[model samples]
Target: MLRLISSIIFRLLFYRFPQLAYSQEEIEEYEKMYSKALTSKSEIKYSSNFPKLHFIQYIASTKKVVLHGSNHKGINEFEPRRQTLFNGKYEEAVFATRDGIWPIFYAVFDRNKLVGNFRNACISSDLKYNYYFFSLTRETILSNPWTSGMLYFLPEETFEKVNHSLVPFDEWISKSPVAPLTKIEVEPEDFYFINKVSYHNPKESVIVSWFLYKLRTKFFIKR
Candidate 1:
């Protein structure tokens, strides 16, 4: 009975909020662009000068599609696997995000070259902007051999929200295997903050690094 009630509530919410539902027209247009990008050998740039939350808002308002980014290529199906987070929490799922810019970070970086990596997405105090911070060791940047990555476009049918309170519109997970409709190749230059990277010692506190990054972004907007 409770499950049925939940399903009804979800249906009501989705009906009341059209953005929560998928749009086949939007998906078709995106796939067409993806094909063009492939022929041109160019990145399908999604990064924007606006705040990250704005991108999330645009996604929720305009078109809602699940996105998964990876450093690998030629993956027809995404299998659910155990993933360990920076906080040590473990889950067996195929993870994804609705925020277009966030996935690019995962798509561009070479995971094997880094000993460790940390990232966070936060909203500003005024709630008008969003911040995304990432940390990596200097050696990781220098040693990374690959200059490109892949971004997978997925349907939202088999996905569920992961953290409704924290990132209600962004984080998602699928417990079953998912086949992507298509994928686009991307490069580091495709990310808006690609030039704003901060290399710190792995031993340093991530909190400190994040704080410094905030300051740098505030003081040095052009850099």
Candidate 2:
């Protein structure tokens, strides 16, 4: 009886708040504009010659698309799934990011290896650039069996902004399945800090002493 009452209440609210809903024609118009913005001359001319920080800033400013990265390839569509995020909360959604560099780490990572990893992205004090830090265990860094992955470009229409106070990256989540408009294959070498990655022990906290990090990197990391 309670479930039925709740359903009726929700239906009444939805109908009463009609302005909160988007019409199918409005949604289609938004998608068309997003697609056009993505293919604009400025977006087409973006190249590696520009600093990665600049690229991220430009994408965030445009808000035309969100990015998702994964080690698995040949993915035509992304379905909403339950995932545990850094905050220890489980959510059912398709996660994406406005920050361009954050997805690159996910693309190159191999979860099957089951090793420790730490990654974070932060904006500079002036808010003009983004800084990234990542570390992996000695064995994982040395073995490095995985070489490539895929970065997916998803339309921004259906995604909602995630308000995460603990994380610095601009994250978005969509409950509906998303089909990628395009995807790019990326290698470890393509990551900006691939050579500068530090070493850490899984048992310990993410923080590593400067001296210990240097010692481990010198002996174990292969660059």
Candidate 3:
């Protein structure tokens, strides 16, 4: 058939003209970014310089996270992420599950430390961990040759970047149900981030985050 003839011709051409198949230039660009990330210092410094959407990763660890995401990727991706938050005197730690939550990556911010977390299992089952940041549009494990993770700016910056669409931080928080915004909605309307984060390919450990939600504030329905 014509398909068989085309296959034979294609193989013959590929073998005889190998240069036509490979682009060495593209590989060079990828390698440059790869080395730049490995050599960068502020990349791992306590203070970060990359933008909210720019990606970063740890040299010592396989984990990838957002540096400007107010110390967390999922939180910083919000339309208005917070910078300084007041923690309660009590040790406020608990499972911060959300409504209609899907299997995704979450970043936790605690005491200046940020960790990207994910879930592999459901909340109803034994509740095991998942490790993969999902690309909502691509529907695949989010990864890049230059950087493995991404970070979004804090809600304050978002407010500015989005043409002051958001109100003052104090006024915004006052309108919320709690003293501070805890659980954020990531629907298309609220935030149009192209990617949904978790983690990709986790090792033997609790990959999910216990500190993702704020430990300081709690909301009561008061029905």
Higher-ranked by lDDT: 1 or 2: 2
Ranking by TM-score: 2, 1, 3
Please report, as a residue range, the 10-residue window in candidate 2 with the lowest summed lDDT: 11-20
TM-score for each predicted model, relative to the true structure: 0.64, 0.64, 0.19
lDDT of 1 by residue, 64-165 (tens): 467877998778889999995444568898988765666777888777777665444422211223345555566665565346788877777888866544
The global Cα lDDT (0 to 1) of model 1 is: 0.59
Residues 11-60, candidate 3: write the lDDT tens digits.
Answer: 32211101112235534443344345445511322222322112122110
Better of 1 and 3 by lDDT: 1
What ordering of candidates by lDDT runs from best to worst?
2, 1, 3
Better of 1 and 3 by TM-score: 1
Let me know the TM-score candidate 3 reaches against the reference structure: 0.19
Collision pairs in model 2: none
Question: Stretches of candidate 2 above 4 Å error?
Answer: 1-63, 116-126, 207-220
lDDT of the candidates, in the order given: 0.59, 0.59, 0.23
For lDDT, the strongest prediction is 2
